[model samples]
Target: MNFSLKRSLTFTIILGIFASCSTSTEEPWSIEGKSDQEVMAIADSLAKTFIMVDGHVDLPYRMNIKGFMITKTVEDVSVETTGNFDFPKSKRGGLDAPFMSIYIPAGYQETGGAKNFADSLIDMVSRLPVTFPTMFAMANTPADIEVNFDQGLISLPMGMENGAPIEDDINNVKYFFDRGIRYITLTHSKDNQISDSSYDTLNTWNGISPFGEQVIAEMNKWGIMVDISHVTDSAAFDALRLTKAPVIASHSSCRRFTPEFERNMPDTLIYALAENGGVIHINFGSTFLSKESRDKFDKMREDLTNYRAENGLSSDDSVYTAYANQYAIDNDVYEDVQKVADHIDHVVSLVGIDYVAFGSDYDGVGDSLPKGLKDVSTYPNLLNELLKRGYTPKEIEKICYKNTFRVWRKVQEVAQGLQ
Candidate 1:
C-alpha cells in the first residue's frame, strides 16, 4: 500500500482499539441493558454488602400489643411472622439497623401514664438482646451500629415516637437517652406539651412550646436526635430553627406527591431539612405515596366516623370496628413500589441523594405499605426499582444509610461540643 493508505489504516485501527476499551470499561451491572434477573442480583448484592439503616420500625410496639412476651424467647423474630418485620426478613432485605419505635399514643397524653407506657415499650426493646443474644443488640450510637454490623447482629436503636412521655420534665430527655433512646419525635397524632401535631385539629402551641424548646435543647445536649415526622409545619419549622443538631423526619414521605397531607413533609420543609444538614427517611405507606390513596382512605375513615355517630356507638364498639374492617376491605388500594422510589427521586432532585434515606414505617403503617415493599425482606425490590431509575451504587449507598449516619455522627459531635 502507498504511505497515505497505510497512515489512514493505522489511524482506523487505533480508533477501533479505543472504542473497544471504552465499551469494556463500562459498568457490567448498570440497569441500561441488563435483564431483570441481573438487575435483581445486583440489588441483592448491594443490599447485603452495605449497611442498610431504616430510621424507624415499630416492632416493639406491635409485639407489645400482640402479647408476644418479648422479654422471654417466644419466637424468633428472624423468622417469618404475621408482622412486617422479623429476623429472617431483615436479613434477606439486608436491613442492618432499624430504629425500634417506642410509640406513645396521643390518648396517653391525656390519661397520663405516658411515661410509664414509654418505659414499658423501652423495656420490651431492651429485652430483645437478652431474648435473642446472637441475632440482635442494642445500638446507642452510629459506632454501635457499625460494630453490630460487623458482628452479624442487627442493631436495634430506639426512637421515641412522641414527647408526651417527657411530659413536663426536660430532665426526662436525659433519662430516656440514658435508657438508649436516641431520638424523640415531638408529637404523634395529637398535640401535646411539646408541640402541635399534624393530624390534630388543635394548634395548641402554634409551634414548639417553651417547655418543648427546652426539651429540644436538652435533646441536643444529650445527643438525641429530634424527629419531626408527625409534628405540624409550624412545629417542624420551629424545630429546624431551634435544634442545635441536625433533625430527622424519621418516618415521613414527600408531601409533594400527596398534597394537603400534613403527616408527610412538604417540599419547603425537605429543602430546609437538607439545608440543616439532616436526612429525610421516606415512609413506605400507600397513602403517604399518592393523593388518590389518601383520598380513598380518608373517605373510608369518614364513612366509619359517620356510621358510628349515627348509631351512637363508641370507638371501642365491636359493631363500629366490624364496619371499619369491612370498609377497609372494600376500599383497599395498593401503591406500586415505584411510587416510593419516585419520592426518593424527588428528594434527590430537590436536595441531593445525601438528604434521603429509608424509614419504611414497617409494622406501624398497618396494611398500607407499597406493593413490592410489603415487608422487611422486600427492600431489595425497592433497591431494584431505584437501580432501574438510574441511581448509581454510590447514590444508593448514601440513601441506604450513609446520609443518616452522617447526620447521626454530627448530632453526636454537637452533643460533645455542648458539653
Candidate 2:
C-alpha cells in the first residue's frame, strides 16, 4: 500500500520470524537452588515470552457442531467462554499458533459427504480472520504464524483430522493444500480408503492403501505434513516409509504409559519419527497420560460395553446411556498436569527435546483433560513442573514452539525440492 505502512509491515514480519525461530537471548538462568515461587515466575514469564504452537486444536469442528455462523460474532470464542480455547484464554496462555483441526468424522465416509463437510469446516476457519481480523489471522505457514505472533494476533492454521475428505480423488490433495490444510491425519476411528485406523480391528487396507500411497506422495509434493495420529501402526509405518518429508503425530501420547492403548505411539514409532526428523506433539488428554487414569476410566467403559452386550442393549439405548453417563461421573480420576509433563518427559527420554512439542487435544478431548491443563490458560503450570525438573529456558522454548517450527520449515523445504 503506502511506503511507511509497507516498511512497518515488513519490519513486523521480520521481527516475528526471528522470535519464532530463535530462543531468548536473556542471560540463561539455573534451577539448582531456586524456590518453587521463583521457578513458577520464570515459567510465567517464559510462557508470555515464547511463541507457543499447539499442533492440534479442534476449534473449527467444535464450532461447526454448534452451528456457529461466520456472519455472527461468536462471543463464546471471541471473548471468555467455557470452552477450552477462547481468544482471551489463548492469549493468556501465550498460545500464538494453534492448528485448528477440520475433523471429518468416520461416519462421513459412509455418508458420502466427507469432502463437502470438510469444506464447510474450512469455511468456518476461513471466516475467523474475516470476523476478527485484529485478534486472529489465517496462517498457512510458519512465517505466517511468526508474523501474526509479532502483531499480537493468534494464528489459526489448519489441519484435517482425517483423510476422508480426499474421498476417492487424489487431486483433492492440492485442492486442500490450496485451502490451507498443512497436515492430514490419514484416518480416524475406522480404516478409510487412505489408511487403516488404529481403532479399527478390520485393518482394511492392511496399511496405506494403493491410493493412500499416492495421497502421501501428492501431499509431500504440495508441502503437507503427513500426520499419523490415529492411523494403525502398519499405516503409520507405511506413511513413514513413503513420505518424502518428515511427519507429525499431531495429537498422540506415548504408549509406554498406557501399554494397552494402540492410539498412543510406542517406542518404535517415536524412534522412527525422530529418525525422519519429525516431531511427536504430546496430547494432554487424561486417558493419554497414565495407566492409572486408563484403568479407572477405560475399564469403566469396557464394563459398560460388556453390560450392554449381556443385556442385549443397543449403545444408544436409554438404559445403557444412563448407565454409561453415571459410570463416567462416578470414576473421575483426571490424571493431573504432572502426567502431561511425564508424557513429554517420556518422549524426550526416547528421542531428545527436539522431537517433542504440544498438541493438546483441547475442545477435542472433552472433559478428560488433566487437572492443571484443563484449558488453554494453564500452560504455565506444565512449564513450572518442567522447570522444576530442570528444563532450561532454551529447552522450554523448543517445547513451546521451536521444535514444531523446525519440522514445519523442514517439511516445506522438502516440498520445495520435490516441486
Candidate 3:
C-alpha cells in the first residue's frame, strides 16, 4: 500500500477514536444544563420517555366518595377534575402506571362488611377500561404496564390498602390476586386480625398475628407484593424477616425526617428493606415530608378530638367535620416540593437510588400535598429537583419505575418458585 493511503487510514482511525472519547466524556442530560429551565426540559423529556409507576394512588376511593359513577362513562378522566389525578394530568406528568388504591377505611375492620367493600372498590377500578377503553386499562403485572406504555394507555393496577377484606380466609389472597390486586397493606390506621398499625395504640399482635404471618407467606406464594406502609415498626420488621420475596413500603416516607412519626420507615428499616432488595416509595404529602407540618396536624387532630368529646359529638358529626375543615384552612400548612426530593435524597444517600421510588399519596392526602406536586401533572417538577441535586437520567429512571419493577418481577419469580 502507498504511504499516503496508509496515512489517510490512520488519520480516519484517530479521528474516530477522538469522536468516541468525546461522546463518552460528555455529561448526561441531567447534568448538561446552563439554567434551571434547561434542566427542567431535560427532566420533562426523561419523564415522558421513562415509565413512571407510582406505588399508590387513591383515585378509586376518592371518586367513590364523590359519587363519581365508575361503571358509566359520564365524564372522562382525560379531562380535568377537582382531584389530584386524572388522565390528562397524568399524561402531562408522564405517569404511565399508577396503582389504584382500593383503600378500605379502618372503620371497616369492625363493620363486618370489609370484603364486600373491597370488592366494590375493585369493581370500580375494573370498570375503568370499560368506561374509557382508549385512555386506560387494567394491569396485573409488570409486563402489563410495559404493554400499556407501548400502547399509549395508562395502566390502573390495584392495591388493597387494608387486609381486613381478606376476612380470615387465606384463600382471599388468591381471590384478590385473581381480581388484579397486586399488593396488600395488611392493615390501615388501626390494628386488625392481620397486623398492628402504626397509628393504633393497641399492640394487639405485637408485630403480626399468627394469621398475618400466613397472609405474608400466601402473598409470596401468590406473587402479591406485601406492603408495609402503615404497619407498626414491629410488624414491618416481622414482614421483612418472613417474606421470601422483597416487600415494598408502597406509600411511606423516611421517618428519619419526622422523628416520632411511625407511619414513615425509620433508617434501620429503610436499610433493611434495601438489603432485602426492596424499595421505599416516597409519599408526597406535606405532613409526611415535614416534621413541623406533621406536628401541627397532630395537634389539630388532638384539639378536634377534645372538642368532639366535650360537645358529646361523634366523629361523623357535621359540626365536627366543619370545624376540622375550617381549622385546616385557617392553618394552611404545607411543605415545599424540595422536601419531597429531600426524602429521596435521604434514601439515596443511605442506600443508593435503586431502593427509592415515588408513591405520592395523591387524592388521599387531601389538601396537604407538597407545593409543586399538588396533582398528577407535577412529577416533572420533582424530577427537576432531583436533577438539580445531581441525579443522573439513569438514576432518575430507576427511581421513577425500574426499581419498583425489579421488586415486582422478583415477587413474581418467588411465586413461580413456590408453585
Candidate 4:
C-alpha cells in the first residue's frame, strides 16, 4: 500500500485544526443494592432511562437472505417471533438506535452486483418507518437519534458491512453517505478492492491497498465512520493510522478472552484504537465472548464437516441440522450474560470507561449467542450483570450510548472541516 507523503502532510494539517470530541463521563445517579430481583428491576428501568446505541445490527441482511421484506407488519422483526430482535423486544430492552447493517457477503466480491445488493438492503431498512410510522425512523445523525428517542420511536441507522459496494469509485463513498450510510467496514470475510480481511489468508493488500487508503481518506472526508472489525491486524493498523477521525469495530469483542480469534481486538490494537478515540462494541455471541466456546464451536464445525462428507449429506439436510444441534447440546459451548460484562470490563481496563459500548450482532450471529443474552430483550440482563460488577448508573449509560455518539458527532465534525 502506498503511504504517500502528500496525503500524510494534508492529513496532519487537517487533524491539527479539527476539534477533539467530548466523551462525557457524567453519572446521573448512583446505585446500591443487594437483592437479585432489585438489581434486575433497576436494570430494566435503566435501559429505559438511557439512549442506547448498538454500533451494528444485521437485520436488513438477515431479512434479505430469508426473502423477508419489511412492511407495515413483519412477524419476526416487527412483532416478537423467533429472531434475536423485534420491535416489541427492542422497546422492552430500551434499545434506541440499532445501526442496521447493510451486509455484503464475500461471494459478491467475486461477482459484480455488490452495489445493487447493498442498495436493496438499504431500501429494506428505509421502508421500516414508512410502513410503521409510529415505530421507526431512519437516523442520519446523533441529533436524529435523540429526537427519535424522545418520541418513543426506534432509530434505524445504516452502516454498510463491506466496501465492495463502493467498488473502485471514491465518489461512491459520498453516494452512500447521501443514502444515509454513516459508516462502512472496509472489507468483510474476504479482501476485496479495499483492505485485507482477518478471515482471508491471502492478505491481498498487505495492509490497506492503495485504493483502500483512498477509501479511508474519502470516508473521513465524507463523515462515514470506518469500521475495522473484519480487517487483518496490518490492515487495522493501517486504517487506524490513516484515518483522520475515530473508527468503530462495530461488533467485535476483546481478543484477551478469545486469544485464538483474529476477528477480535488484542490488547495492543485496542490501546491504539482507544487512543485514537474509537470505541470497540462487544459482540454478544458465545464464540466471541469465550475462548472455550470458540474451541468447542470450532471442533463442532470440523466434526460436522467430516460427518457431512462421510454421509454425502447436503448442506440443507435435516439430519445435518440435528447433528449440529446435538453437538451443541453435548459440548455445552455457550457462555452466559456475565461473559459480555467480562468483555466490557476488559475494554474498560485497557482503555477507560469512555471507549466501550454494545454492538450485539443480534440476528446475524444465529443460535450461537450467549445463554442469558440470546436476544434483544436480554440487554437488561447484561445490564444487571454490569450493575452487579459495581458499574455506576452513569458509567452504564456511557456504555449504552454516549461513547458512540461522541464518535458519531466527531466524525461528522471532521467531515465538515474536510469539506
Candidate 5:
C-alpha cells in the first residue's frame, strides 16, 4: 500500500504544456449528429498525442467466472464471452494503459470471501504474463505504464473495486498491496465492515464505518489510492475529509446528468473532490449518465426482483448484474461516449480541466455504454467527439491520462509525508 513510486512522464510533460495552451472552450464533437467514421477519425487524431488511459475495467471477472485466459485475445463481447479488453482493440483505440480491476463480489463479505476472491484475482493477474506474455504486463505505477508502453506492452495496474476482501482486518490490506492492488474502494452496493456503499440497502455506519476510517489510514500509509466511487455520499465526504492524499473516483459520473443514482457523485462533492486535488473519471454507463436511462434500468431491476422472488431465487450482485446486463441488451440502452465528454466538460467547467479523467467501467457494466463506445477500442470515438467539441490536443491529453497521473503523484507526496 506504499504509494511511493517513480515520477510519471506525463506528469512532467503536461505541467509545462498546460502553461502555454489556451483555456478556451467550444464544442468539438458533433452532439446533434455525426458519422461513426468521422468520429473515429477525430479520435485517431487526438489519440496520437494522448496516452489514452482507461481508469477502470473488470477484466478479472472474465478470468474468475467465464475462465478467460489473460493471454488470449478476445475480439467481441457476447453473453458467453468474458474478455472485453484485448491487445488488438487497445492498439486500435490508441489506449496506453488500463487500470484493471480485481473486484470482489459482495457475496465474499461473509466467511472467507474476501481472502478467496483476492487470492483468485491475484492468480488471475499472475497468469496474465504466463498466458498472454506478449499482450499483458503488471504495472505498479504510472511510470511503469509508460515504460511498458515504450516496450509495446499493455500495462495493467491492479485496483480492487470493493473493500469486501479486507473484512475489517487491517493487515489484510497489506496483503492486497503485496498482490499489486494500488487502490481499494471502501464499499460496494451494500455496506460491509469497511464502510457504507452508495448502492447498499443497509446504511451500516450510516455513512463511514469505524473500520472504514482505519482502512483509509492504512491505505494512506500504504499509498493505495482511495477510490470514492461506489461509496455512500457520507462515506465519500468522510473519506475525502480523512485522507491526506488526493483520491480518484475511478469510475463515477455527475449526479446532475443522472440524478438520484447513488453511483453518480453530486456536483457539490465533485467540486469538493476537485478542491481537495482529487480526480473524477467519467463513467461510460448510460444509467450513470441519463436520468431516463437510469429509471428504465431501475424498473427492469424491480421487475427482475419480483420475478426472482416469486421463483424463490435470492438476489445477489451476479443475479442483479445479469438482469441489468440482459435488460440493457433487450432495451438497447447505450450511453453515447460523447456524453462522457460532456461529463469531462462539466468537471472542467467546475474545477478546470485538471480534475477529470476517463474511467470506462468496461465489462463491469454490460452493454450500457454510450453509443459508439461499445468496448475497449471504442474510446477513440469518444476522443474524436471531444475534438469536434473543441477540446485541444493538450486538453484532451490531460483528460485522457495526465490528470490521473498528477493526482497519483500528489497522493504519493502525501503518502511520503505520512511516512
Candidate 6:
C-alpha cells in the first residue's frame, strides 16, 4: 500500500479511460467536419426507427458491364473520392435494406432483349448465395426483406428497370417471376417494345404501347410489382388503369415542384398513384429534385454529346462521362439534402406520408445526389434532418421503409388473387 504503487495504478487507470473515450469518438469521414460518433449519436438519440428501403440500384452493369465486384468493404470506383458506395460504411450509417436493380441496357428491346437480360439478371442474382455468401442474401418476398434486416444482412432485392428486356412478349413476365424479379420499370430513357419513355424523342406511343397493356396484365398475374419511373404520362395513366395491383415509381419525384420535367410525377399522377394504393419512391438525384440543377446538368450532357460528335470520338464510350464530371464540378450542380426532405414533404402533403419512400439512384447516377445524402451510408443524416423537420418516429418509420413494404405486400395479395 505504498504511495508510489498507488500513484502508478491511478495513472494507468486514467490512461485506460482516455483511450476508451478516444475510441468511442472516431468519425466515419475525414472530409466532413462532423465526427462519426457525432453522427451515430444524433441518429440513435432521434429514436426514429429508420429501416431504410432503397428502391433502386443498378447492379447488373456495375458488376457485369464494368466487371466490378462488391466485396464486404468500401470500393473506390474512380479517381474521385466521393464516388461509389461502401458496404461497411453503409451498414455503419444504418441503411437497412437496399434493393439492387438488375438493369438491362435499352439495346435489347428489339428482339431477344427481354429474355436475354432477364435470364442474365436472374442468373447473377441467383448466384449470390454461392458467390458472395457472407455479404448478400436474396429477398423474394416482403417478409424476407424485413427478415434480412433483422439478421443484419443487406437484402439485395431484384428490380428490373426496363421492359425492353422483355421485348414484345408477355409470357416473359412469367419467366422473369421465376427468375426472382419482384418489380419491373415499364421503360427506360427510350421507348422500348412495351411502351414510350419520358426521356426519348419518340411519339410512337402517346402513352402505353399495345404490348404494354398485355405486359401489365402478365405482371399482375406473375406477382411482379410494376415500376413506372421513366414512363411517359400516357404510359403512367395506362398503367394505373390496367394494373390490378399497386404500382411504384421506383425512383421519381413530384413534377408539381418542377413544372416541365417529364421524368417527375405530376400532382395529377400523384393523386392517381395514391388512390391506386401505390407509392412514389422519391429519387435522390440532384437534377430530379432541382430544376436549376437538372437544366444545368442536361445542358452539360448536350454540350458533351455535341463536342463528341464534332470530334472523331462520338462513338467513344468513355468520352461522355469524362466531359460531364468537369461540367458538374465547375457549375456546382449539386442540391442540398434538404431538397430531398422537401420532396418527401411535398409527397406527404399531397398523398399523405404512407405513399412515399427512398429510392436512391446509387451508382446509376454517381455524383448527382444532394450534399449530405451522397452515398448509401449517409442515410442516417437524412433521417436526422427529417427528425429536425418535425417528423415523428412512426411517420419516419413509414417513410423510411414500411410504406414500400406495405405496397409490396398488397402487390403480392393481388398476384395471389389472380391464381
Best by TM-score: 4
Candidate 5, residue 288: the lDDT equals 86
Total clashing pairs for each candidate:
3, 0, 0, 0, 19, 5
Query: TM-score order of candidates, best first?
Result: 4, 1, 3, 2, 5, 6
C-alpha displacement of 178 in model 3, angstroms?
A: 0.7
lDDT of 2 by residue, 37-58 (tens): 7667767767777788999998
- Give the per-residue lDDT digits (tens) of candidate 3, residues 201-297: 9999999999999999999999999999999999999999999999999999998889898999999999999999999999999899979998878
Task: Show model 1 residue runs off by greater than 4 Å.
Answer: 1-29, 68-78, 300-332
Report the lDDT of model 2 for residue 191: 93
Of the candidates numbered 1 and 5, which has the greater lDDT value?
1
What local lDDT does model 6 show for residue 85? Answer: 50
- Looking at model 2, the pairs that clash are none
TM-score of each model, in listed order: 0.87, 0.86, 0.87, 0.89, 0.82, 0.81
Please say which candidate is ahead in TM-score: 1 or 2.
1
lDDT head-to-head 2 vs 5, winner: 2
TM-score result, candidate 2: 0.86
lDDT of 1: 0.87
- As a whole number from 0 to 100, the lDDT of residue 320 in candidate 3 is 85
Task: Give the alpha carbon lDDT tens digit for every residue of 261-375 in model 4.
Answer: 8999999999999999999999888999888998888888889899999999976899988888888888898888988999999899878999999999998898898888877
Instruction: Give the range of the ten consecutive residues with the poorest summed lDDT in model 3.
Output: 14-23
Using lDDT as the measure, name the better of candidate 5 and candidate 6: 5
RMSD of each: 9.4, 5.9, 8.1, 10.1, 6.6, 9.6
Query: By TM-score, is 1 or 6 better?
Result: 1
Residue pairs with colliding backbones in model 4 are none
Stretches of model 6 off by over 4 angstroms after superposition: 1-40, 44-49, 70-83, 302-327
How many angstroms is residue 112 displaced in model 5 relative to the true structure, after the best TM-score fit? 2.7
